[model samples]
Target: MLQVKHLLADKGNRIYSVAPDEPVLAAIRTMADHTIGALLVMRGEELVGIVSERDYARKVILKGRSSSDTPVQDIMTSPVISVNPADTVDTCMRLCTDSRVRHLPVVENGKVVGVVSIGDLVKAVISEQGAEIEHLQRYIAG
Candidate 1:
């Protein structure tokens, strides 16, 4: 099974984050700048929460709140569901499905290393399946 470490190795451990006190608009800008769906809410290297486009939509837009006036912490999802580097892709998938979250922060030794989205898990699974199919085809042809 593919592990979170393997996915991080392939995708690179690049963490995009926003300060908890920052305005939601700033967090949205960061996400837009990176072309990502979510941003880790950090407070001086500590992961406090996570803010995604969905959060903005539900907490700010739908509520008729001003993104520029609202702090990211106000809309950010807290007590985030995270995964360890050693965790399998299958485990990550289960967590995402059960939690109804799209992003999972990868932690190791009590430190944040990276973040993986549901899209990443799906891509890894598809790649693994393709490799397995190729291997089985070669074995059958031999």
Candidate 2:
């Protein structure tokens, strides 16, 4: 069973975050610039919320709210569901599915470490499958 730590070891567990007071537009711009879907919202060093593309589309665009005027705290998902380095990829998959969320921030000792998305877990699963297939093929060739 592959652990989240294995993934973080390769990715170096860096989480991009923004202040909760930042404008919603700032979050949107950050996502666009990073080519990512979400941003972890923080107040100083404390994790406060999470902003995603869905939040902007549903809360700001649909409601006709001005992103430049509204704060991310008004839109971000609070009390983010997080994971630990020791958590298994299967656990992360289940959490994302059950929560209906694509991103899960990893934390240790009350500090944000990294963020994992559904794509990350899927990629890991594919890599594991490929390795297993290669092993089986090698056995058959032998």
Candidate 3:
């Protein structure tokens, strides 16, 4: 089975993070600049929470809260669900589905290594299937 480490190896695990005390607007700007959906809320080196577009739409826009005035901690999802590098893609798929979350921070030795999204997992699965199909086709032609 494909693992999170395998996906990260192919994708180049780069973690984008924001501070909890920062304004939500800043986080939004960073996300836009990176073309990403979420940011890890970090306090120094510790992973404190996660902020996403969904959080902004639901917590700030819906409530008519000013993004510039609001801190990420106020809208960020805390007590994050994380995974290890050795975790299987199937395990991540189940975790994301069961938790109703799109992202999972990869932790190793209590340090954040990378983050994986639902899209990443799906892409990995599709790639794996494609490779298997190619291998089968080669075998059949032999």
Highest TM-score: give the candidate number.
Answer: 1
lDDT tens digits by residue: candidate 3, 52-100 = 9999999999999999999999999999999999999999999999999
1 or 3, which is superior by lDDT?
Answer: 3
Q: What are the lDDT figures for the candidates, one per model?
A: 0.96, 0.92, 0.97
**Judged by lDDT against the true structure, how good is candidate 1?**
0.96
lDDT of 2 by residue, 4-80 (tens): 88888877777788888899999999999989999999888899999999999999999999999999999999989
Q: Best to worst by TM-score, what's the order?
A: 1, 3, 2
TM-score of 1: 0.98
Better of 1 and 3 by TM-score: 1
**What's the C-alpha lDDT at position 87 in model 3?**
99
**Model 2 steric clash pairs:** none
lDDT tens per residue, model 1, 1-142: 9999999999999999999999999999989999999999999888999999999999999999999999999999999899999999999999999999999999888799999999999999999999999999999999
lDDT of 1 at 80: 89
Q: How many backbone clashes does candidate 1 have?
A: 0
TM-score of each: 0.98, 0.96, 0.97
